[model samples]
Target: MARQNTVHAAAAVLVVVPTYNERENLATLAPRILAQGEQFHLLVVDDDSPDGTGPLADELAAADPRVRVLHRASKGGLGPAYIAGLTTGMKRGFDYLVTMDADHSHDPADLPRLLAATHDARADVALGSRWTAGGSTRGWPLRRRVLSRGGSAYVRLVLGVDLRDATAGFKCIRASALAALEIDTIGSSGYAFNIELNYRATLRGFRIVEVPIVFTERITGASKMSGRIVAEALLRVPALRTTSLRPLADVRPLADARPT
Candidate 1:
């Protein structure tokens, strides 16, 4: 059995926020993320936001030891930003790494539920789902809802993933699951990245679980869900399902053990 302190110390859950020009949202969202008690670390990966979100992240990090910032030169999409954060988290030896939007679409309060699902429910990857029972969406336009539901259904059929909110950005992923992946091989960006990660995990036999979360439209900042992102996801879903290459490692069984 793993030592209690090992599990507790390794249990550094950092909320990874990939940002680009999210100045409006960052100001408000950062505080909310920090307010999720002191259990989580907030990692704000700014793609050198011309809107000054990077400096804001620095300012926030300086104020809070639990907060940190990673700066990238240009807007390389959400996938790269997350990869950067994941790499840093792995190097620093954290046990759990979470990815969510800085735009407030993913609530900070839901963080604890996702964490509990991972620790108590024995899930390798706990997803915050809006399509599951007790889950819902608020303040979204009809077109957005239709697009999301249709895209999710299409991916489910094509990729054969059983997840309800496969495209959702809110997730609590164990570092062990991430270490099992050849993340360097993941080539998709934006929405496609989400599907690719989940698909690869399923292929490696990870114990993924969904926790219901109410999805809400961002109260500030312009939405970044572009047509290109959607199109890329639609295309990548089929390609990933056909790949037979095994992952770098298989840690699904570790997810079976209760979090110490």
Candidate 2:
């Protein structure tokens, strides 16, 4: 899909933050996202968090017009939660959609910078990458860093994707580019979902740009990573190399609209 001719400053941008049990983080994260700029709106997708994050998201939505919450009946995994949020944001006429972590690992302060890069670079997708030049991580042990770097390398070698950080979660995607993707057909559910989406974007010939970012470890909340998630990524990467993807199409652009 070619870049839309509309001016990005006037575009409606929706930031989708997927949360499991992030009540403590949302309290601080929500306000920071809203403070980014007037063009930004926030969508918190909660998977029936046991820690009351869902109701807290409701409260935030009630308090601010720029904030909205999507409640899931059960924990369906990260990929489904994000897909639901992105579909809702697109249906409501957002020109751009951002996906990020709610645990503060992906900084809200970098939100504007990511959005700007997508527009300035005329990129269909802009990834906040830790492996790229000037990008780094904080509060991680050497083993964790090695695992992350190794995972990226493995995905690159198997999938032949050029992105430095193929599994990066922080991203700014043009709505048209997203609509072109067969999101309903994506099979990966864990962190591998990030890699699949990036790969699909590349397959469709979308211009993807990497924006250097400092990924911070979450201070609160338990980590969601598990052996099962790791196993899923390991099995899914090689499978994706041979999988045939659907062709891209130019979907209708969001009405030159803004949230009231």
Query: Highest TM-score, which number?
Result: 2
Off by over 4 Å in 2: 1-8, 245-260
Q: List model 2 lDDT by residue over 45-112, tens digit each.
A: 99999999999999999998999999999999888888999999989999899999989999988877
Residues forming the 10-long window of minimal summed lDDT in candidate 2: 249-258
Measured against the true structure, the TM-scores of the candidates, in listed sequence, are 0.89, 0.91
Q: Local error of candidate 1 at 152, Å?
A: 1.1
Give the Cα error of residue 3 in candidate 2, in Å: 23
What would the per-residue lDDT of candidate 1 be over residues 1-260, giving only the tens digit for each residue? 12322344436788889999998899898898777656679899999899999999999999989999999999999888888898888788877889999888899888877777776666778888888777889998898888888878987898777777778778888888889877777898787888788778778888777778899988877888888888888888888867775542223222343643
The CA lDDT of each predicted structure is 0.80, 0.85
lDDT of 2 at 190: 88
Error of 1 at 55 (Å): 0.6
